[model samples]
Target: MTEPMTDLPCTARVPADVEAPDRILWGLTARQIAILAAAAAIAYLLWRAIGDRVPLAVTAAVLVPVAGAAAVLALGRRDGLPLDAWLLAAVRYRRRPRLAVPTEPVEPSGWGPVSERRPLPAVLRLPATAIDDDGSIAVPDTGSVALVVATTVNVDLRTGPEQAAIVGAYGRWLNSLTGPVQVVVSTQRVDLSSQATRIADAAHELPHPALADAALDYAAFLDELAEHRDPLGRTVTVACVAPAGARGEAVRRAEHTAASLTAVGCRSAVLDAATATAVVTAAVDPFAPTDASWPRTPPNDPVTAARSS
Candidate 1:
């Protein structure tokens, strides 16, 4: 007998503006209200000062455009932030130093011409100050972060019940969050040269001549595809940050989060310090070689000074 479909416990229609700020008055946020109120106060003050000297029509003409601009700045959004915030960010970006260096900048000696003395290079400050031996990242004045790499599962291919189960599992993880957790999914260009080479090298080890020829053909095909097309790979990583003074807790949280996510059919593992360093380095510069040793040395920790004679 055919069974009727039942309601899914995990599925529901969520609004698009779930993260939108709460509307305090007349559908405007607190920030929007504050901006409008400030502009109104300024306009009122202008009117009080100019009422005797200036004509009302002329004053209105000058204030109308200013009022409209203030409304736009308060109500409009650009690049996911309010217009005022975006403008502030643009101003900050323009004011920041053009040149930056990894090493700390030293003040120039008082012996050179003012024009000849170049602007001191700005010290580059990375989000993470250091990578501990146990894989925790030291975030200056914030907390420690631990990275866990997880495999992705395709929910579209799953049946209705299976999809619901996966959703429920994911919901559990979301509900369990006490502190900040970031799930980063990134795609990068993949180089298939090494893979082709490995396959080609192992082609002769096959038992049958036909199998060996097939492997060789596959290797050649891979080389041709790689040359003709750009292949990309996706990686999913979860970064769990523990509060200040609880560095070790970050690692435990990462492992626990990995275990919790297993219900959704994702296989995950916590990255060790060396592997985490490599991952971070690769993210900063995708064109750089993966096995570079420079990333192993954390910022401000001079390798030369630590060397024993």
Candidate 2:
């Protein structure tokens, strides 16, 4: 006699090219078919126009290269994008402004010393205009977005039923999305210098000499590890975008996301304003130190020396 199965997890093999465009005909996507059709039509038109005047050999020589080039451009891909799109992007990148200043425009005074040689700066305009006190990032024309930091759940460590539950919960969250959502996983270098320093400092307070020595040794080990090897830390964040004038909705979505993720054996939370700002700052300049107080300093504000304590 066999015992009843306690748990059964439904599993499916997901293809690597799940996001690939569906093939419409002859193993070609709709876009590819359209491109090929256009290329063929252009070749036919050229042949009709010059077939009578030019020798068959010369016409074939001219049209063959052009048609081949068109076919390659239609079929080829570069850097994960279609060749045509890549070319267009390269062109746009070449044309884009190389230098930009803050969005704040200063009215030039006619009384100032004339410097005609210097070029005027172009304004740097980003989609996000401001971050609200409630952690909502405001976009000028689009909408507000709220961020939620989440921990990953290890499905391999869980039982079949547990894995199924985790997957189901995650799917529910994905299905409930009414607006654009972005999940960002980032890894950055970890600096253990502060921890080492703190441990070294507290080593004296351990009471026993053996414990103190052990703490000191551990601190020294951390310092050596930090100096010789590059340690890394990973963070996962979810950005929920809500339509304009719906900042509260974005926050609610973030909270909902956090709650859903919690059910999957993952720790998650909606970031506060300061934490959100810190996250953004870290993303923008990963190497920069950013322990600034709440309500971030304006980029255009003048720097003034503060009185020493």
Candidate 3:
């Protein structure tokens, strides 16, 4: 090995203003400047509209709070949403009492910005034109893409040292891959009652009655738990997308991903056409039901019996 050279030429220098992360206005940051400027603009507009009829003192009194509130709502985030969003929530929250089997709203805000809540024509937001047979999403503007959605392995369940080891291994594994992969975690409200029912049913079909009874009791317990609990479920999915013309490449990449996941001691399933559609649907509307709910008639109901008969 060659000895370390003390005289290495330096080729790189830090760019100017790189340390200043955000825009500064006068002595304050941009957000502060925006708030002040917006409040002033609101006050000025209001003064021009009604200054002739109203006294200056009355105008100032009304304008101060209104302008301040507007500025804060527009510039600040509350509950991870702008304060203006709380206004639209009022309508949805009001309907809470009327819900039959209440499902949590997808968005915490359950609302839109107050200024944006004003009457305006609806806008088309979905860019996707179709979902291809190979689970590719087709967008007229952006073209086709095949995607993979996989489950997440829990790191918290492992011990501290194990977690560190896993992290190191995962880092290495990530380094091995050349393409882009996105990790997404969705917080959902899932209805697991049907799965529990199936589990209990399968258990009851076994030879031992005791085991069957125990399984049923456990399923009932789980059902109760779901009803009483927060209903929040976190699903982790890793996704990779390939272009429309490259379906084979997408599948190859997905297969490699599956093998990597298996090597890491994690279970993962790639989404099929239908499941991918549902996942996309849920992403767009998180409040969408995790499972289908079909109507069932009461055992003693006359109309149900009449139809069957």
Per lDDT, the best of the predicted structures is 1
Task: Report the candidate with higher TM-score, 1 versus 2.
Answer: 1
Clashing pairs in 2: none
lDDT of 1 by residue, 150-262 (tens): 99999878777888888888888888887789999988766676677879999899899999999999999988988999877788889999999885999999988999888
Evaluate model 1: give its lDDT: 0.83
Q: On lDDT, who's better, 2 or 3?
A: 2
Sort by TM-score, best first.
Answer: 1, 2, 3
The TM-scores, one per candidate, come to 0.81, 0.77, 0.48
Question: Which tens-of-lDDT digit does each residue in 1-309 have in candidate 3?
Answer: 998644323232336864453758566556556767777887898899999999999988989898778667656666755454565576667654442322433332645455454222233446676665555566565445445545566776766656666566666667666566677877887776775777787995878889888888888887897778856677766666555565555556666776677666677666655666766766777776554222222222344334554
Model 1 TM: 0.81
Residues 73-181, candidate 2: write the lDDT tens digits: 8899999999888999999988777778887656678888976745456789877777777888887787899999988877898888887887888888878888889
Please state the error at residue 110 of candidate 2 in Å.
13
Which regions in candidate 1 have their CA more than 4 angstroms from the true location? 1-10, 13-15, 107-117, 194-225, 287-309
User: What's the distance in Å from true for residue 278, model 1?
Assistant: 1.6
